[model samples]
Target: MPNETLAGLTILVVEDVTSIRSLVVKLLERLGCEAVCEAADGETAWHHLKRRKFDAVLLDFELQSDDGVSIAWRIRGDDGLINKAVPIVLLTAHDEARIVEAASKAGVDDYLVKPVMPDRLGLRIRAAIDKRQDKLDRQARSTEVSWKA
Candidate 1:
């Protein structure tokens, strides 16, 4: 893949802390991302989504108002509510097995602990986006096959 494949991609950064949010957004920018939207909590993030479409969401695990898992659940539960499908990647300070399990149960596309290196963040973003696209492609193929049947 080209280094700039992420160019023109719009991402939402949902975190309570201003500094961490800025850091993550900057990291995405360095990787050729075109736009970054900010949200301090899940509620605000949901409102932002209502106004604009985002290609992906970098969500913090915990927020003062609402948790990232809840946001991911809402996004995944109503695929038709938005014009475009978004991948949700969780960034947390904790990486316990149970936490990871919970994230998976909530439909998170990817998980990363805080203080992640830039290279690792880029790799994770690519993997999550690619995985989501692959799933979408498979679903399309399956629908086509069924229609012919």
Candidate 2:
């Protein structure tokens, strides 16, 4: 919709709850993602991350077996991941300060509360991607400057 801001972008959605995962997939499709992959748990999500490159990742904060912050940690810390620098958005029902702080330290780009609205979801996704891109651009520029010196 609206020229499809996320058109042709591949994304990963990791959520344990079947209903919530389905809802997120539907929303991503509506947002015009070319390919949206789903993972029910951290293991499945890790499998996808290792094998495929995603433009962004949307993770549920609480899963049946693992938490989203831990997943974010692996994504950021592990050099083996195909998309280690990819933007991550954490979704959660809890609004606790500690949860947000942990996610932030784990390199999560954005956080959203449960029962996400379409507009807010779109905004958050865009913001996360933009923020990550900005960081990458800065890193590239720093490397260029260092080489020039």
- Using alpha carbons, what is the TM-score of model 1? 0.89
Number of the top-ranking candidate, with TM-score as the measure: 2
- Give the runs in model 1 whose Cα sits over 4 Å from its true position: 1-5, 146-149
How high is the lDDT of residue 24 in model 1? 86
Residue-level lDDT tens digits of model 1 in 23-56: 9888888888989899998778888888888888
Per-prediction TM-score: 0.89, 0.93
The lDDT, on a scale of 0 to 1, for candidate 2 is 0.92
RMSD of 2: 1.8
Clash count (model 1, backbone only) = 0
C-alpha lDDT values of all predictions: 0.83, 0.92
Candidate 2 residue runs with Cα over 4 Å from true position: 1-3, 146-149
> Could you tell me the TM-score of candidate 2?
0.93
Instruction: Looking at model 1, report the run of 10 residues with the lowest lDDT sum.
Output: 78-87
